[model samples]
Target: MTNENTAATALILGATGGIGGAIGAALRRRGWTVKALARDPAQAAAGWQNGPSPLWIAGDAMNEADVVAAAAGTSVIVHAVNPPGYRNWDRLVLPMIGNSLAAARAAGGARIILPGTVYNFEAGTTTVVDSTTPQSARSRKGAIRTEMERLLEEAAPDVPSLILRAGDFFGPGIRQSWFAQTMVTPGAPVRRIVNPAIGAGHSWAYLPDLAETFARLIEKPDRLDAFERLQFEGHVDASGTEMIEAVRAAVGRDIPVRAFPWWLMRCLAPFGGFPREVVEVEPYWRHPMRLDNRRLQRLLGNEPHTPLDTAVRHTLEALGCLDQRGTLSQAA
Candidate 1:
């Protein structure tokens, strides 16, 4: 079916989230009927429910019956749901995905779109990862992500799964990322930029661009492998200064840059919470890694790329850092 065909329905599991919201918005703009599952539909709809607002389905992703019911008549199942606050991932991540897989099977082989992550591979792997790169995740979260992909790969024949792995994500409405929490304080004017990358070249994915990539890939599903897994080479900064420069250009000022507070995170890690999780994944920031998107380029010719300055400007504006004229807003 064509993108605007009413029959082209998508069920987004985490439509309330950053990536899911972006994808849902993109699909809606493409004329796809998008539905999102949330625990409390009424409350979620009141929030910034991500682009053009999806048809909200009231249900919890952990409930297999709920997901199965929501998957009915859906052509694409975007499995973007995850536990809240990054807690209980060990106990929650697998079961939720299992539910999604079962729902996909029940829907008679709907295409499953998953926003992939770098956690599938450890630092020992090639600094540059592609479709065929071997995965040996060393961290606990990485292992969980690796297992998630393994399950998807195993069920590919029955589900027609598509996995697009990308690096650290930064985009509008994304508040929990390194860019949001570490680099600049959200709901406040841009001040000194924090460089957590520790001189390590980090791969960054602009969410809307990545979401658009998904929409394009879905348009030509027939060309994809039954278990297609592609890499998204969004923006690769070799010296880790490119992103800083982008931020500088976006805000139109040379904000003082500071090293990330590893010592603070280390102290908080012992107390347990998001800081602990952040500390656990320090290796990624300390080491350089990038995804190779040649396979994606072969399929789509060119992946969506927003200029870093433009992307950063939009992100800061959405985060309430910049005014309409690109000047810093009053500090919160």
Candidate 2:
């Protein structure tokens, strides 16, 4: 397949997910031709498919033919595919990585951008982390991520790729996030697990901010070499108490937070969905993990972060938390 056009195109895998959807929207706003690939096209968010849309391709990232077709005529490929659950990793991560690398190679040197996480870091690290921070493969998830990076690096000899690692995400439409249905609901059973008095400084990445960062990187693909890793410290060093307070202020209510009991989580780990691997990483929630973003700030030139209150409010609104009257009346 060939094209006679000169305009750039970006193919985003996993476009229905939180980060991928945001990145797709950002790219579309930037006037790039955005092609989104997902397993089920019907599952994609509303209004993302209608009208003069960026091409929506239905495909699985693990399928070579699907990926190859999706990559055709694209200048950049964003690898955003993730397994549905923690237990699926042992079966899914490697194949997906391999297929993505193959698709990028087949695309005739398109820049491959991967959204990464802090799972590669270890416990008890005081120094702020950057691209050069020593990765400790201490946990199962961390080791899997490290191995994925290694695979990308090994394939870098023939493919141009970049990995941008950000912190835990919190933004609109993120129901599964730590602060979503778990912590923000009033009189909910899940609220008891999200104590804000733990005094841990955790990183939280807002989806829109990360999406904009990825859009900027896409515009300047030449800056990426055979392989590069970047750290985007979205928001830094905010304690759990401060975060909870900010959220409460945003929503105009006093939300309660209780400490997450590791013992209870361990007990529940035997269940299929809540695997032991999820409980094994509980230390991250209990300790501080700081990220250094000097490079990201320097590259992006002092973009203002989303204020905590505004971010929290926006998240709540997206979750329909603000539609109280209608929801309450319906329940009644």
Candidate 3:
């Protein structure tokens, strides 16, 4: 399955992560030849226990030569790798992107696909943003994200790129996201749902659906521009309470709802990096940043979408929140 010559060949740079792994599986399901580059193939291959495996090429993404060599004969190179736990992220993100751009150029105009974030936008902007929105970053990560897209844009026709920008991700195999880290406790039954973005609208992208959208675009490269950016309007919880309601429905009961304790995280910020990182994104929870996907819908006829309750249920089961509760995940 790894080395077959298919109509569409994609080399996934971060196949062990949520977006990269999901997209790799989705593309493979659609008959694309998939290859993955990893520093430790044995450890990275464990991430695909439940799905088909990609050609696990032993390589590091930071090395331009490794990326360029692995990207040979590939039509798409997905730049999804990031510094673990945001450690040295600001210093490392751009160089990794530069390497991807170089690898794309080496592959003779192979498209570089980046799974983008809302960090590129101003915090709490109420307006729904499209692909061309002028990014005014509010934090250092946002600035880094903005610069990453700038690199892709500068690459142009020689190294055409696709940037599918979306909001927060919540789905199966995602353990570090807001849904897993703050919304629901991992490995524990749902006692009470913790909501950080209670009253404000928030854009959420289910990994399965997001991965499918990438596959659709990769299926037809003609629709893409030399350097294109498409905003995916995932499950828009216009009323921030919708997600909480969906969570309750997914578990088939009314559960207590609790507002996330941002103050506690702030108090503990000095003691650890995780809490400090969590405190920085409080603005997103306080305000809304929605995406407009009319451009995406028109291109694909319709954007891939899943019901919020179903998505939440699957995520809960994956996180083990639905365990010990008989037949919860099995219920329709």
The most accurate candidate by lDDT is 1
Per residue, candidate 1 scores C-alpha lDDT tens digits across 1-332 of: 24746579899998888888888888988889999999999887898546578899999999999999999998899998888865698889999999999999999999889989888778745588888888887777888888889999999788989999988889996777889988988888777898988756789999999999999998778899999999999988888899998888877767899998888999889888877888878878878888889999999999999998889888988888764444633121
Q: Arrange candidates by TM-score, highest first: which order?
A: 1, 3, 2
Task: List the RMSD of every prediction in angstroms.
Answer: 2.7, 4.8, 2.5
On the 0 to 100 scale, the lDDT of residue 181 in model 2 is 43
Which candidate number has the best TM-score? 1
- Ranked by lDDT from best down, the candidates are 1, 3, 2
Stretch of 10 with least lDDT, candidate 1: 323-332
- Model 2, position 225, has a per-residue lDDT of 55
Candidate 2 local lDDT, 1-332, one digit each (tens)? 12223387989887767777777777877777889887776666454632245577888887888998899988788888777643477779888888888888888877778888788888667346787788884877888888888888887757878888877788874556666745666323222226523456778888877887888776765566578788787666465676677655654545566666667778888884554765756767767877777766676676448887677667666665655542343245
Query: How much lDDT does candidate 1 score?
Result: 0.86
Off by over 4 Å in 1: 1-4, 323-332
Between candidates 2 and 3, the lDDT winner: 3
TM-scores for every candidate against the unseen true structure: 0.94, 0.87, 0.93
